[model samples]
Target: MDTYAVHAEGLRKRYGGKDALAGFDLAVRRGTVQGLLGPNGAGKTTAVRILATLLRLDGGRATVAGLDVAKEPRAVRRRIGLAGQYAAVDQVLTGRQNLEMFGRLFHLDGRRARQRAAELLARFDLVDAADQGVEGYSGGMRRRLDLAASMILAPDVLFLDEPTTGLDPRGRGEVWDSVRALVADGTTVLLTTQYLDEADKLASQITVIDRGRAIADDTPDGLKSAVGGDRIEVVVGEAADIPRAWQVVAGVCREAPETDHGERRVHGLVHDRVAALTEAARRLRDEGVAVEDIGLRRPSLDDVFLRLTGHRTAEEKAGAAV
Candidate 1:
């Protein structure tokens, strides 16, 4: 109904003396996927729980689909869907059975429940596995069924918390396709994940959070620009050439190149990728500095995350693991 499907301002949460969310703010636009990126204990899930009306906030305010989660949780619940980190389907039940059970819990009549299950089965491409017990389903199929369960009411907004954490590449791709289909049908989504590539592919905008606070928010390109321009990187064939390689890269790029002594690598930002690449190669050739590798590449979301979070998402593995 509103421009934002979900909105939060100054959200605060506390567990004993430790803060889970500290004055956090976020906005997810309608009909778009907004990646809530953060390391473990960075308040990504805390903010989601507050907006989803599953947990009470100590301070601040949030709303979903134009209804205040705090003042009108029932109204918000009717307009939102939530799929947590793990698949939330029954192992003993058939894929179709799981959908029907969720439909019944949502108050659909028996006929309507069965019909809804069939619809979800087809929608998620689970028709072949519909009658099969979830126990035999692959990780991807089970997760898809879990997502279908969340869509029982076809809520306006969906909150996906690391929908593909443990899946292999193929399984993760399946979940990604399902999410894309939902967005195509105009569902707004808030996705949280540690996989930078997932956000790079699916999120129209990204919000970077750390230490229970909002650190950066923007489109993927915008966030990457915050780190620096295109990078010029070189690996010298000989360790002794590292210093000279750095000088060449720094002189051409006009920035000091960062060196990895162990790898004999030097990298830094550059103004023009094509020109920088050509010039660096030529300079190395002229200077007799043999290079093992060289390239000009754009900054990835991983670079942006490291610049903002001060770590390579290591904290998320144990704490959030998203």
Candidate 2:
């Protein structure tokens, strides 16, 4: 068995003068969920499409299940499944009928196709909705069916692009559970999503791509450590306290400031959280400044993105028009 289900080195693709994917490199270990995170138009879709054999790479090399995407596109497709942003099911077809259609398309015989359809319907908990037309299914149901459709042939690798977009919290959790189940069965998954929490929750390794290049890549915890250790956030009583609080904190630490509503806050990276907090409190009291609240917490993936990319995902989206 191959140690890596997916591997690419210097994979490049161009659209006119712009490079959609510029010398990208990735290695997805077998049975691991690798999160591909980036802002919109960051070439995530292009990369997934190329790896799934839907598009040709302009340069470099890529292989799925050790089969070259360029020379053995059919073999690659046979071993990998793609669930795109929108569920691609035919609205007029019943859920069972949809899976049966794909199973047969994969060349399963009539008996085997029916069996596969039944297994998938039950696996996705769509047996109740099996005979109903997909047009009447909820967004979450359709998404589940779409995933089940891709697994009809039991592909070794599954590519999920924004698997839970537009889903409510419950629907998102359902999709997350399904992805976890697939990994439990030894499936290699590549998940792309705009939701940072989704990636942080699911991915064993995360690659953050920007524009057309990879800006950062690491495990969730490792990425968080890159920004700093624990964060000590101080909310002051008044905006005027910002300068004084910053002056005291800046002498011992370096961090950014964030203000919202009527609160002025500062976040500091700490080597010793307890000591840092104690000193911050003592300094504030000595200066007769009222401290509204203080907190010490772990650095989130959002902080990692800000430190590495110099912009949050939202900021990147807003700057897209430039």
Best by lDDT: 1
How large an RMSD does model 2 have?
3.2
lDDT of each: 0.91, 0.87
How does residue 25 of candidate 1 score in lDDT? Answer: 89
> How many backbone collisions does model 1 have?
2
Candidate 2 matches the true fold with a TM-score of 0.89
lDDT of 1 by residue, 1-322 (tens): 3799888899999999999998998988999999999988798888888889999999998889999999999999998899999999999999998999999999999999999999999999999999999999999998999999999999899999999988988999999999999999999999999999899999999999998999999999999888889988899899999888988898888677799999999998888788889998999999999888898889898889989988786534455664
TM-score of each: 0.95, 0.89
| Candidate 2 C-alpha error for residue 159, in Å | 0.6
Residue-wise lDDT of candidate 2 within 47-77, one digit each (tens)?
9999999999999899899999999999898
Stretches > 4 Å off in candidate 1: 315-322
Report the number of clashing residue pairs per model.
2, 0
Minimal lDDT window, size 10, model 2? 252-261
